[model samples]
Target: MSTVPKRFEILLVSEHVEDRGGASVEDSAVRSAVVEATGRHGASGYPIYEGHGIVADIDPETRTVEALLVDGRELDYGLTALVRTAARG
Candidate 1:
């Protein structure tokens, strides 16, 4: 058995996701959703997503997600609330 963290909600303010793709995701825009695999979530300090500024590169891992920007930044935060807000608006 593997020790993986439970699936959590996050803000995927990018165009690409792990498995599913949708219309809500736009260029440089932020979309709220829930992800399972750890690679989909990155550590703290990285900017979640910018409005067509830095290149959002997401590196997926087994138990963690590493995100890098064109300027070399990171995004780490619990995006549950953001997702809820974005979906409503």
Candidate 2:
């Protein structure tokens, strides 16, 4: 018998600050990439946005996941870490 894959939700929040000069990432592209990466992990991913970051509710059983891929690199940090990193960059 085969086990059913679990479903997860991924939320990406991005806030556009005036000082940032309206700089922002392409949301649609990111969503598509996340969906594809999640599929590869034998799980379904749903991408959501709030302000200027990402929120993901993943299975604890999942050991690894490509949270975000940008500029030929992959970010595997949690929502909080990702947010902090983005703030610094």
Candidate 3:
């Protein structure tokens, strides 16, 4: 996979969130928060393009959040940084 992948997964971890402590790694609260935070028109503080978008899917079973980017325009440095930051979170 390239540095920036069209499809990437972000592990749901406590470092990415405020609170932690659950019987299972697939905590419902964290999964829901990640989904909403990375979803369309979300509050992740990331830029939203008019024609392009990134779809975030949460899999509680895997305790992971995946983002599939649909870029209509050319991928640039800023977008790459954005993905990197999102992946970090």
TM-score against truth, every candidate: 0.23, 0.21, 0.19
- List, residue by residue over 1-89, the lDDT tens digit for candidate 2: 63423333343333333353454533322332122113333223533222223333233344233344333344434321122112211
Kindly list the per-residue Cα lDDT of model 1 for residues 27-60, writing each as its tens digit. 3345434433334333553224323323332322
Clashes of each: 5, 11, 0
Cand. 1 Cα-lDDT? 0.36
lDDT for each candidate structure: 0.36, 0.31, 0.31
Give the clashing pairs for model 1: 13-30, 39-61, 46-74, 46-75, 47-74
- Report the number of the highest-lDDT candidate: 1
Q: Quick one: RMSD of model 3?
A: 13.1
How many steric clashes does model 3 contain?
Answer: 0
What is the descending lDDT order? Answer: 1, 2, 3
Clashing pairs in 3: none
By TM-score, how accurate is candidate 2? 0.21
- TM match of model 3 to true structure: 0.19
Which ranges of candidate 3 are over 4 A from the true structure?
1-52, 70-89
